[model samples]
Target: MIIYQSGLITLDYDPATDILFINWPDVQDFLVPEIRQALLILVDHIKSYDIKNLLIDSSRASLDIPGTEYKEVIKEFGHNLMQTRLEKMARILTPNSTRENKVEEARQELRFPIPLRTFTDSKEAYSWLKGTLAEPA
Candidate 1:
């Protein structure tokens, strides 16, 4: 069920799967600081509900953060996630090579403690989260 809805993002939680899906607003761009704050709020929801899996659909929203700011944001997000019960996260992004590369760079920098993957398809993302995909070697 949808727990939060705003012009920037919409949050939905599925109790059966214990997954929280964060859907970004279409045609909206957010600065690093704004994104960071939003992320903290999202983390709070995960903590409150004890959510273990997260699906972030970023196909619509664009991040307007610079390279340095992006690094900081990812660092803070990774730190906050570490304190939660989140075990896995799947991010669905638009098929933009530059944006995808930037996200991968940030992921590598964060060295996130839990499993995190990116996909261009939401179906594939959710399937992986549901453990329908083969485990990585």
Candidate 2:
């Protein structure tokens, strides 16, 4: 079921898998503040629904912010996410994009607080969230 829908994002919950799926709007079309607001809304649903697994499909998104500013915002989001009930998160990135490697690197680095991973395939992400895919060793 869709829990929230806005110009910046759309959130759907799958009770069967206990996962929340987020479809982020194209980052080139919106400012960071707008995206941040949508993310805050997502956190609210995550807390309210006790979401354990999250899948973010950002295959069409890309940030245009400076490196320093991007890092700052990511840090803030990380702090907020650590306070949630999330155990794992899978993000689907644009395949073959220039930023894919960078995003994957960030994913690996941020895997401490939660088991976060990046994928270029949505089916892979969904399978991982549904516990059908074997966890990496």
Candidate 3:
């Protein structure tokens, strides 16, 4: 079921798998503020629902956040996530795309590990989050 949605974000939940799928179809060339707003709302939903698993699909969306600001979004998002009950999170990014590199860089800049990863394949991500598949070795 869709918990919250707007022009920039769409959030869907699968109760059976206990997974929250956060879609960014409207994130094309979007900025930090827009993404930050969406993240805040997303985290709230997680807190309110006691969400433990998450799949963030960004394969179709593109962000335009500049250098430091891009890291800002990731940092803030990661920081907020630490306060939640989330067990694991996977992100789906378009394979062989610049966005993939950017996201990885931002994640590394966090300077600490979190139960999050980026994937290019949705099915693999879903399976991993569902505990039916293991993280790629």
Instruction: Score every model by TM-score.
Output: 0.86, 0.85, 0.85
Off by over 4 Å in 3: 28-31, 95-98
lDDT of 2 at 77: 66
Native RMSD of candidate 2 (Å): 2.4
lDDT of 3: 0.79
Model 2 poorest 10 in a row by lDDT: 98-107
lDDT of 3 at 36: 87
Model 3 lDDT, residue 47, Cα: 95
- Write model 1 residue lDDT over 1-137, tens digit each, in one string: 99877666678999988889988654335555667778889989899988999998988766555656666676788789989989999999765566677667777777777999888899889899999977669
> Could you give candidate 3's per-residue lDDT for residues 1-137 as a string of tens digits?
99888888878999889999987674656666777888999999999999999998877665655646666677788888888889989988764365566667766776546577777898988888888886567
Task: Provide the clash count, candidate 3.
Answer: 0
- Candidate 3 TM-score, true structure as reference: 0.85
Q: Rank the candidates by TM-score, best first.
A: 1, 3, 2
Backbone clashes in model 2, listed as residue pairs: none
For candidate 2, the per-residue lDDT at 107 reads: 46
Alpha-carbon local distance difference test for all models: 0.80, 0.78, 0.79
Residue-wise lDDT of candidate 2 within 80-111, one digit each (tens)? 78889899889887653545655544445565
